[model samples]
Target: MKRKEYAWAYLFISAPIVGFLLFAFIPLSYSVYVSFTEYSGYQAPVFTGTNNYAKLALHDELFWKTLFNTFYSALSIPIGMVVALGIAMSLNQKVRGIRFFRTMFFLPTISSVIALTLLWKWIFNDSYGLLNYLLELIGIQGPAWLSSETWAMPAMIIQGVWAGLGINMVLYLAALQGVPKSFHEAAEIDGASGWQRFVKITIPCISPTTLYILITSTITALQDFPRFQIMTEGGPNYSTTTIVYYLFQNAFRYMSMGYASAMAWALGLLILAITLLNFWLSKRWVHYE
Candidate 1:
């Protein structure tokens, strides 16, 4: 009977297993093979050993530039976290219409990404855009945000933070709710100030959630591409190009599939290293109760 049950369970799950092998595992394996060869999409792959990797390491200045842009854009992760946590704390108050306010805050997360990006693109337009118009009213002229090398990355970061705020706020709100009232009450009785209770009790209790957000946000930031594609198309001077955007360009535009594959693998290794580092560092501060 147990054997029959196990067979039935496997039978039910086999569809996904087959799909993974067909769609994900096969492509991943082929990409690894392709990374060692020179291939355009139309031609058979020509084996090139480590030449692609060597060129990336030694000759490609754009590789380093895009990598730098990727990490620089990740600055939004910590800024978003702090802003989202503050928003979550504000929404946690017990008041009428709080649920409605929460919904408003979270609406952007469920909205269409393409639509949001398009909207932001217009908002950052150099002339007659709402942002620059507001700046003009304050006696300050906004730069040509999406066109200026100095400001393009900052524009991307601002949009990224705004678009990501809803999801992060929701996650932090859930974590905030899970913290026990008794802990705060006890701390209050001990004459802990409001800020002390928050810093000492609330933050520790939510450390696991913080770690989760940090890891996910870092990965998302590193793989960012859509905004770069739509907002700047890698930019006036390649200023906003991220690693993933550069990879996309090589694979599709330049027809350097082998080099793109190598970049993909390098990015994967980077993500893995960072995630492992986050886990290693979490041992010191991520308290679970």
Candidate 2:
């Protein structure tokens, strides 16, 4: 009877498992196979045996540039996560209309990416943008935000941080609420100052949430694509050309499918390496009790 029950339980999940194998696993396997071949999408994939990777390594300057851009975008992860945690903590306090503020903060996460990108594009516009207007009011000259190579990547980073902040804030809010009230009260009775209690108790209790935010935000920053394609198009001397954007251009624009496949594999390996490193380091600081 137990065996039959177990069989039925597995049968219920079989459809999704089969779908994963067919749609995701098989496609990934085929991409890996074709990375060694020389083929555009239209032609037969002839086995070239690592030539694609060799060319990408030896002569592809754009590949390295795109990788560096991705790294720069990822640099904001720590700062953004700290900001999100602060927002979450403030909202978790004893205050009225908490739901209203939470909704306001979270609505941006659901806004259309294209719309938000265009909105920020105008905000960062050199001529009549709000940013320039504010800077002028403060007696400071504003630089071109999206048009100049120096400001284009930073503009994208600002937008990326804004777009992602809400989701991470909500996650931290939930974690903050889950912490025991007894801990905070005990710290107060022990003559701990507000900052000391926060540093010792609040931060340690929230380490798991911090770890979660760090991993996901870093990955999102590294893999951002849409605005890079639509807004900058990797322009202003390739300042905003992220790895994924470059991969899209190679696969679709240049019709270098095999080389694109090689890039895709390399990107997956890099992300996997970073994620594994985060997991390994979590043991040192991420506390659960």
Candidate 3:
């Protein structure tokens, strides 16, 4: 009976294990091999050692530019987190119709990215855009957001923050809900002001959630692609072209599979390093019960 149970357990789990080996592990291994070779998608991969990485590091100006762009755009992560926390706090209120407000706040997260991008593209238009029109009403002239190099990345950041706000807000809302009301009551009884209680009691309890949001948001920001592909096409002097978008261009558009694979490995390593660093530093602040 014990042997039969173990066999059945393995059998039940084998499908996903096989799928992982076939789809994820195999492909990942192949990509590592490909990254060390010179190959277009159509050609046989030829061993090229570290040439792709060397070229990306020392020769490709666009690589550095896009890396910078990626980080710059990733600024939205913190900005969105802050804004989302506020929204989450607001939604956590016990007032009537709070559920409706929560749903409204979370709607954009579940909506189609393409549709949101298109809507933002229209909103960022210099001529007769809703954003510009509103600015104009205040006697201010809105710049050509998508067409201007200086403003394009900021525009992308704004849209990114808005688009991601709902999910982050939801996560924060859940975290806020998980916090014990008893702690707040204790702090209050000790003559702690609302702000003091929030600072001393609420923030520490939510630190783990904040760390979670930070790590995930950073990964998402670093891997951002679709928004730039749709909204900017990396235009206005490639100011909005992130690393992932560049990797996509090399792999699909330029047909440089090997180089793209190298980039993918590089990006993967970067993400790994950052994630490890987050975990390392989390010891200082992230609290769990």
Better of 1 and 2 by TM-score: 1
lDDT (CA) per prediction: 0.96, 0.89, 0.94
lDDT: worst 10-residue window of model 3? 197-206
Q: Which candidate wins on lDDT?
A: 1
Candidate 3 stretches with Cα past 4 Å from truth are: 1-7
User: Can you give the lDDT of residue 47 in candidate 1?
Assistant: 98
At residue 85, what lDDT does model 3 achieve? Answer: 94
Q: Summarize candidate 3's per-residue lDDT along 1-289 as a digit string, tens digits.
A: 9999999999999999999999999999999999999999887999999999999999999999999999999999989999999999999999999999999999988898899999999999999789999999999999999999999999999998998899899999999999999999988888999999888888899999999999999999999999999998999888889999999999999999999999999999999999999999999988898
What value does the lDDT take at residue 138 in candidate 3?
100
After superposition, which runs of candidate 2 have C-alpha atoms over 4 Å from their true positions? 1-12
lDDT of 1 at 42: 95
Q: Write the per-residue lDDT of candidate 1 for residues 1-289, one digit (tens) a residue.
A: 9999999999999999999999999999999999999999899999999999998999999999999999999999999999999999999999999999999999999999999999999999999789999999999989999999999999999999998899999999999999999999999999999999999999999999999999999999999998899999998798999999999999999999999999999999999999999999999999998
Give the lDDT of residue 258 in candidate 2.
Answer: 89
Task: Supply the global lDDT for candidate 2.
Answer: 0.89
